[model samples]
Target: MSTRPAAGRCLVDLSAQDRLRSRAPERAPMLRVLCCPPAGAAAGYWRFLVREDVHVLGAQYPGRESRFREPAAPTVEALAAEAAAAVAAAPWARAAITPGASADVPLVVLGHSMGASVAAELASRLEHREGIRVALLALSAKTAPGTAEVASTGAGTGAGSDEDLREGLDPLAPGADAAMVRWLRRLGGTPEAVLEHPELLALQLPALRADLRVSMAYDRFPAPVGAPLLLLRGTEDVTVDPGGLEAWRPVSTGPVQRREYPGGHHPLADHGDRLLEDLLACAASGRSG
Candidate 1:
């Protein structure tokens, strides 16, 4: 991969929203949940998760959406650090300390697929470096960090030639071409129009490939995180083993809960309402405890 300058900041500004639109009163502290999208996806993937009580801010990765021209992050650490910086700088992080609030507002981190590991790293960074408390960490459709290799299907190291890259992605899209369309079809998120267009698919491949490399190359620490954890998996998600989902129990010192939904890999889309309800309940439980 060609070395390039880091991408421009992609954080979405929630502070700019009209205060009247906030369902929570000025004196009422609200939970802020920062979400990280899965590989080959952008922040917009979480737009369907909008809620009136909690603030849902999605982390935008490089080389996608508004950041399409920038280079994708080379490592999971780089991505996590950048995301942490963006979250720490957000106005809500400081607003929690304002006089009207009864207590410090809670912050929760949620991620899906490859983003599970990224969210874990971000939670650790916030807790250790910024002294921020992560009320809960919600992970979906991914195994514990440092364990992906155990179940990975021998995909190429993500650093091979173009043909090798295509070959590695073959299992992901058996009879289809190694294009974004194939992956998008398998994942069931991207719009049909975008997937059908060769030009659009080409535009998404760089970031997708970069994110895959980060997942393949990630090296996680053995130590567990301090925050409570909730693992959500799709019952039909063949990509992640049930045992692997259960394995996350030991990764957190706080309580760990697992829930299964009826869908494939993208359970959030199929079960967004249920997941959101559970996420809020988990975060509240963690905060109260």
Candidate 2:
């Protein structure tokens, strides 16, 4: 893989009604958060979460963000492993190295949607394989592994062929057509230019296909995880089935807690503020749950 410079900050002009935005604190922070985006999505999508005393670091997977110039990983396990490596090597390595952070502020993992599983797997890899200690894990939208009762991990709503992958993803992308763009607008997956650019489309689809494959063929972790796990879901979430949530019971080694929102599939976005409060509350109240 080739090395590329970090994405240079660029300014985008948007209407107040059309633009998505978040506020970051202007001073030093106590805790730093490592955030991972959902599948078919890029890093920095969670820019809205930066706030007072909180520094949010969004993990950029290969094939997206500055890593877009590099080759995408072929499997979820590979991707998860790669992300774990990056976290171990980050500039703040001293803050949350193996065995947990040295400071009082806890090292937290907040993964939304597909990110929930990705985050869980990352924590598992770090602790079980790499010997890193994760203070707490906040998993949103996705159920615990083996818990998604209404949905199966393998074979998504989209067909398996690369061509089908392109077609299924095109709608979630930005520029297919007014109708397709509208569809993507609702999904909130990619940027308008990416959906319109063929070059970027070429870069994104293979990675997207690989992630879907990971989702489908993914097997549960060999054993239950030891970290405190908090599961969040939406009452109206189409992708998260109740049976799926129930399935998570057997896979977690620590105490398991569930929080359900009143919205659809994307519960975090629908209940971002409430979700953030609950996550912080959960992390601050205890050591091991």
What's model 2's lDDT at 274? 75
Model 2 TM-score on a 0 to 1 scale: 0.71
Query: For model 2, what is the C-alpha lDDT against the true structure?
Result: 0.57
Q: For each predicted model, how many residue pairs clash, with residues at least 3 apart or on different chains?
A: 0, 10
Best by TM-score, which number?
A: 1
C-alpha displacement of 11 in model 1, angstroms?
1.9
Deviation from native of the Cα of residue 198 in model 1, angstroms? 0.5
Task: Please give the TM-score that candidate 1 achieves against the real structure.
Answer: 0.80
Worst 10 residues of 2 by lDDT: 9-18
RMSD of each: 5.2, 6.6
Residue range 178-267, candidate 2, lDDT tens digits: 433344444444667987786776666656655655665565653555666777767866555665655556545767677888876555
